[model samples]
Every structure is written in C-alpha cells, then in structure tokens.
Target: MKYLRKLVIGATCLVSMAASAQWQWTDKDGRKVYSDRAPPSDILDKNILKRPAGRVNPLVTNEASLNAASPVAAASSPHGSASAPKLSGVDKELAEKKKKAEEAEVAKRKAEEERVAKSKIENCARAKQAKTNFDSGIRIARTNEKGEREIMDDATRSAEAKRIQFIIDSDCK
Candidate 1:
C-alpha cells in the first residue's frame, strides 16, 4: 500500500509540472491557442488557462509528422498531379495593363490618321485653286493674241500689240 501511495504522488507531481510549464494565448479571432513559449505582450489580457486537446500517440500513426517534414516529397510522389494549377495575380494585372496600352495606341494612331487625311484634303483644294488660276491666265493671253491678229491697219495693230503686252506683263506675269 505504501509503494502504491508513493507512485500516485509521483504521478500527480509530474502532471502538475507539465500543466504549469505550458503558456496559453488567444488570437485576435478569439480562438484558444497554447504553446510551450509565452505569447507576445500585445495579447496579455486575452490569455487564459485551459486544458489542451487530446494528444495523439506517435507510435500508433506518425504519417502526419512524416508528411509535414517533407511536404514537397509527398506532393511529388504518387499522390501528386501531373501539373499544378495556374495562378492569376500579377500576371493578370500586367496583361490587362498591356491590353489597355495597346488600345490607347490604336486610338492615337486613328487620331493621327484623321489629321493626315484633313491635311491631304486641304492640299488638294489649294492645288485645284492653283490650276484654275493657271487656266484663266492662258485664256486671257490667247484672247489678247487673237485681238492683235484681227487688226488690219498697221498702226492699230501696233497699238493693240502694246496693249496686249501691257496686259500680259501686269496680269499674266
């Protein structure tokens, strides 16, 4: 009976020591958390003493620990897939920005094309005006030439020739 009492006392002391060493903390989400180390100073008021969850016997199943030790190895094994899924974070943003830039460039090119078309139209109008002025000048010179040839008298012809020469010098030149 004395040996059994001593064993019970030893077991109680070991349990008390284990309970005293663990520090407890509560996260911002109000979830209870316990660790071997003390929590940060910001969460001092939320700390509370509580019993831990049931402990798993490592001898029975160490598969969880084994997978945690090398997660990459487990993923690459038979359980892994042929390829991982694609993520769309920064690449998606860059693609959208590139599309916007291309659209802006296309708009700018269209505006430039409109400006060029307007300039071509104005140049064509100016060329047409120049051609009309040239044709009018030729008609006036031909009329003066015909008037001089129709004059039979030499003095009248000479006077008309002088007038035609003056008209040509003033208007045609």
Candidate 2:
C-alpha cells in the first residue's frame, strides 16, 4: 500500500513538471505569445516574460551595442512594424472562386428554365395534335384497366378533347 501511494505521488509530480514546461513571451506586436517550445531566434531574450524551470536567461549583458541586443530591429523595417499586424482584405483567388460559383449557379438556373420551357412547348404541340384528332371524327382506341382495347365513345372523346384543350390553353402561349 505504501509503494502504491509513493508511485501515485511520483506520477503527480511528473505531470505538474510537464505542465510548467510552457514558454510565455511578448512579441514585438505587443501580442502575448504562448508555446510549448522556445521563441524564434530573432526574438530578444528580454522579450521573454517566462521560461521553463532550469532554462538559462540569454539576456545580453553588453550595454555598449544596442544593435547586438536586438536583431529584430533590422528585420522590422522592410516588413512594417510588428507592433501593428497588417490586416489584409479578402483573398483574390477566394473572391474569384466565389464569382465562378455564382456564375455556375446562374447557368444551372438558366438551363433548368430552358428545360421546363422545352417540356411545355412539347406538351402544347401534343395537346394541339390531340385536339385535331378529336375534331376529325376518327375512332380512337385506348387500353382499359382490364388490358382490353376499348374504342372511345362520343362522351369519352368530348371529355378527352376538353382536357387536351385545357393543356393547349395553359401551354400554347
């Protein structure tokens, strides 16, 4: 039981040590940076606010050369001051992709409308032909539910003609 308790205590201590291994520093941009590893080599040791246990401070002792203390000053000029991070507008490639997607959507909608219009035109032509068949007084045969060939009588012909005429009225324009 004592050995088990000792093992648990040792494990807890190890976990706590690992948790304290994080690095905390303030970047030139005034942003507080936190990471598991050390900051970039360009970052001066003075900028580091916190370091893991047993880590040596590399703060430059020589006051004679300010330039030797900070290499970041040189890199800072060509790229704007790191104190203010540049905010960029929307990416050009992303904007183009969005534009293409919108155009594709418009084209898809146009194609769908054209398909529906073609279907309506075909329906109108078929309805007009049916109307002509009924007006000509020719006998028309249809398949009944019993699978038998049945001749359309006057009443049936009139009803079918009315239905066809309704299709023509709705679609012919």
Candidate 3:
C-alpha cells in the first residue's frame, strides 16, 4: 500500500509539472499572457516576469551565480541557451499543428478563389454568346410571369443587349 501511494503521488507530481505554465509576460497591449510556450521574440526580457525553471535571463543576470558558474559551463548546459527558453516537445508539436492549420487555410482560400474565377469565366462566356446571338438579329423570346412565351420587341432586344454587355464588361476582365 505504501509503495503504491508513493508511486501514485510521484506520477501526479510529474503530470502537474508537465501541465504547469512555463512562461508569463505582458504583451504589447498590456495584457498579462501566460503560456506553456516561450513569449514572442518581440517581448522584452523585462516584460517576461516568469520563465521555465532554470533559464538564465541575460537582462537580469545574477552576478554571484555568473561568477561561480563559468560562462563555458552555462553555454554547455543541457537546458540550451541560457538567455533563451528551451523549446519543449510540446512546443514543437503545437508549432507543427499551427503551421498545418495555416497551410489548410491558405489552401481553402485558393480553392475559393478558383471557384469564383471559374464562375466568372462561365458567366463571361454565356454573356458573350448571348450578345453574339442578339447582334445576329435573331428574335429572342422569354416567358412572362403569366407563364406565356412573349416575342421580344426592338426595345426589349436593345435592353437585353445592354444588360448582356454590362455582364461581359464586368466579368470578362
């Protein structure tokens, strides 16, 4: 029972440590930001009030500790650059997910643009064909709201030609 309790407690501690926020900083808009990832490079060191456990901030150098620990040793430490946050595996995963989301957004935008372009091209082609038919002196007929087919008069044909020309002007270019 004692051994199980100790194991459970240890596991909980490890989980909590992994979940705890490692970065805290005031953003440009003055909001305090708490994140498990490093603050953006634009954030000044003074704005970063907290960092993951043992990163040595160059801006707030501890003179005594710096003297005791050789510069070579600090640079060679497993934690990475003393002045910068060590990127954890979680940060890498998050970065990869963000990049994929951005790519997906770009692809979605490209697809929408292509669809709009295709629609415009189809509209332009149909309008040009209708304009050609109108110019060829063919009498066109349209159904009225009363469900009766009506032969177009000269005024109606000219008006229709104007509308088709407007569509061609807007979509062909």
Candidate 4:
C-alpha cells in the first residue's frame, strides 16, 4: 500500500508539471513575448526563443535576472522595457511657468539689493558732507516744525556732527 501511494503521488506530480508548459517567442515588433499557448506554425520555427518547463515563463525569468544583474536598468524600467512617463501638455506648461517664476523672483531680489546699495551710498555721501560743514563752523539754520526759523547753538551743532559721524561710520562700511 505504501509503494502504491508513492507511485500515485509521483504520477500526479508529473501530470501537474506537464500541464504548465510555457512558450516564448519574439513578436513582429521585435519584442520578446510569452504565452501559455503555442505559437502559430508559420512563425513558431523562426520566432520561438524558449520553451521553459514548469509554470514560470522564460521571458519573466530572464527579465528578473537581468534586473538583478543591473540595478540601474531596474530603476529606469520598473515595468520591464516600457518607456518612461511622458509629460502631458498641461504638465509641460506648468513646468515652463514655474521656471519663469523662479527667474523673475531672482531678478526682483537682485534689483532690490541694488536699490538698497544705492540708498546706502547716497546716505554715506550726505553724512560726510554734513560732518564737513559742522567741522568748518558754518552756521546751519532750519525752519522748526512750528514754522519758526531756529539757529543751531554750538552744543546742538556738536551733537548733530556726532550723529552724522555715526551715520557715516555705519553706512560707509
């Protein structure tokens, strides 16, 4: 009974294995193709590449092995030799707009930097001129906020000179 059971089990295994034949061939487009059914008689002899045993197809097995051998190819072709994703019309337009916006932002920032630099240079020049006038003892007068003409005293002039000097020191650098 034991020997008979072993024989039956081995025959069943052989029959299951025979039922899972796979045929591989190159299609008219030159791409490798895999199928469970046999190719047509006209193209079978010329295009047939592999007749792999068991259930796993040769095309899939070869692709897996190829991917494992070269990781770069696998990264680029996740679904085997299919082409990369193409950008649609809307995506292309969005990409272009994003690039233009980035350029505009950079230009605006540069223009702002230039304007600030020019303002600092003008401030430094005015501060230096004011300090020179105070040093020469030139009597500087100004109309007050109340519309009264007021002459600066010596102490006031000295304080103004010190303030202008501070401005020059801060902006000239």
Candidate 5:
C-alpha cells in the first residue's frame, strides 16, 4: 500500500514537470506553432525553440544519494586492498637524476652571479680614481694655483681671468 502511494506521487510530480516543458516553431510560409515535442521535419531548420525537460533538483538528488553506491570512491580506495600505487623503477631513477641536475645548475648560476658582483665593484673603484684625477686638475687651476704661486699683480689677475673664462666656456656651452 505504501509503495503504491509513493509510485502515484512520483508519477504526478513527473507529469507536472513535463507539462511545463515548451517549444515553438515557425512554418515555411510564415506560420507559428508551439508544442512540447520537437518540431516536424519540414520546419526543423526554421525558427524552432526547445525548452529541455526539467531535471531532478540537485539538492534533493544529492541528499537522497549521499551514501549510495559510489564507483568513484570504490575505484580510488585501493580496490578493497591496502596496497599503494607505486612508481616504476625507471621513473624513480629518472626523478632522482633530474633533481641532482637541477641542483648543479643552480650552484653554477650562483657562482656566476658572485663573479659578476666582484667585477662590478672593481670597475667602480677604477672609475672613481679617474674622476678624482680630473677634478684635481680643475681645482689646481682655479683655487690652489692662486693661493700658492707668487706673481706680479697684473699677471695674477690675468691668470684668474683666464681660469674664470675657461670655466664659463666649459660649463655653459
């Protein structure tokens, strides 16, 4: 009796769901038609619309079958045995060799970077020495020469004028 009642209720739900399914079609000479079933062959390529039959509600389906037979869990869980998936011997050896090669390459890169950094420091020191020598020449002509070298007043004045002119020409041009 209970099984019969359940069957009747299930049939009623399916009928109601199917009733909501809709489709539309247009004929060749501009006529419109609608039906739940697929369109006839003549207007198959014309303006045809099909609303798919409803599916069982996902929440209801999942709740009803949460613990039911699941092939996914069975296949993944070791075929009812405790043995684990094992890599082949060749694959294991290849993985170890690849790891060692990667480590060696990393070490080589680190050594190259250290060499470049040391070379840059030496080059910067050389550049600083050249700049210091050039600056000393300019200082001697502008300030140090005037302070230390004894000369006639006219000659000293002319030398200072020449230094000022040289600075202006070099800086402003």
Candidate 6:
C-alpha cells in the first residue's frame, strides 16, 4: 500500500513538471519562443504561439507539422519523397560511366607502355650487333647523302663504336 502511494505521488509530480513547459510569445524578430515557465503577466495572450501537450518545444517546428501545413514546401524539401525515388537509377548510371572511363584510360596506358618496351628492345638488339661488328675489325660502310658507299676510317669507326656502346647502355637497361 505504501509503495503504491509513493508511486502515485511520483507520477503526479512528473505529469505536473511536464505540463509546466509551454510556448510563449514571439520575439521581436517574429521567431516563436518556448519556455518551461509561463510568460510574464505583462505579455499579451495574442503573442502566445501554442500550448502543446507533453513537453514539446513549440519554437522547433517538426517535419510532420511543416508537411501538414504546406504540401508544396514539403515536396521541395531535401528529405522529401519527390527526389528519393529517382536517385537510385541516376546514381547507378553515373557510377557505370565513371568506371568505364577509368578502364579505358588504363588500357590505353598499358598499350603505350608495351609499344615503348618493344621499341627499346629493337634498339638494344641493333646496338649490340653494331658493337659486335666493331669489335671484329670489320670495315663498316655507310651511304652518304649523295648515295655513295663510303668506307668508314679508323677514327670514324672508333667514334661510331663509342656512340653505339652509349646507345646499348641506355637502351638495354
């Protein structure tokens, strides 16, 4: 019996405490204001915004109330239903396009690298053959601009061999 009495007294106190919260007058800026205590006696009743049940803060307008007040405004809100349905399709298409573009770029880069590697291998092979001919004391001949075959001299052969060795060092790496 004593426990039930204490529980009832506690429940009454909680109910009264919650009921004490109320919406007061709007400020000078026209924004609604809420308070746990009643407005001063000097304030007019007309300025009072609302006396919501429970402990709802009247100054903070919830989504349900805003949607109830204006259907058009609710439809245009970011969290509204209008834009939600179309987002999935648009996002998927955009993601697919972005992925394809990235894949194409990677393929182009790989093809270019392969071409460069083939060119380097060809150059290294030619340079190595020229170096071997130079080491064998073979008389290297070149076609001059006038289309005449000119046999390379010892000095010219030495310079050509040095140049070929340099090419081999650079390209074989």
Q: Which candidate is the best by lDDT?
A: 3
What is the C-alpha lDDT profile of model 4 across 1-173, one tens digit per residue? 99999999999988767655667788878888777787777664556776657433333455666578677756555356557665454777788999999999999999999999999999999998888888887789989999999999988888888899899999999
lDDT of 3 at 22: 74
For candidate 5, write residues 122-147 as lDDT tens digits.
65565555445454544333335547
- The digit string of per-residue lDDT tens for model 6 on 1-173 reads 99999999999998876766555567666776777767667655656665645433333456677578678757855465666555554677788999999999999999999999999999999999989999998778999999999999999998998999999998999
TM-score of each: 0.33, 0.54, 0.51, 0.47, 0.30, 0.54
Q: List the residue pairs that clash in candidate 4.
A: none
Model 5, 44: alpha-carbon shift in Å? 40
- lDDT of each prediction vs. the true structure? 0.59, 0.80, 0.83, 0.78, 0.58, 0.78
Span of 10 residues, lowest total lDDT, candidate 5: 55-64
Ten contiguous residues minimizing lDDT sum, candidate 3: 54-63
TM-score of 2: 0.54
| Winner of 2 and 4 under TM-score | 2
Please report, as a residue range, the 10-residue window in candidate 6 with the lowest summed lDDT: 52-61
Candidate 6 residue runs with Cα over 4 Å from true position: 1-62, 70-83, 86-90
> Candidate 1: where are CA atoms >4 Å away?
1-90, 138-173
In candidate 1, how many Å is residue 11 off? Answer: 39
lDDT of 6: 0.78
Can you write out model 1's per-residue Cα lDDT over 48-78, one digit (the tens) per residue?
4432443322333345554675877445433
Which RMSD does model 6 reach against the true structure?
Answer: 17.8
**Clashes per candidate (backbone, < 3 Å):** 0, 0, 0, 0, 0, 0
**Residues 11-98, model 2: lDDT tens digits:** 9999878867878788989898978899999888788877887342445223324345467643443243466557587788999999
* Candidate 3, backbone clash total: 0
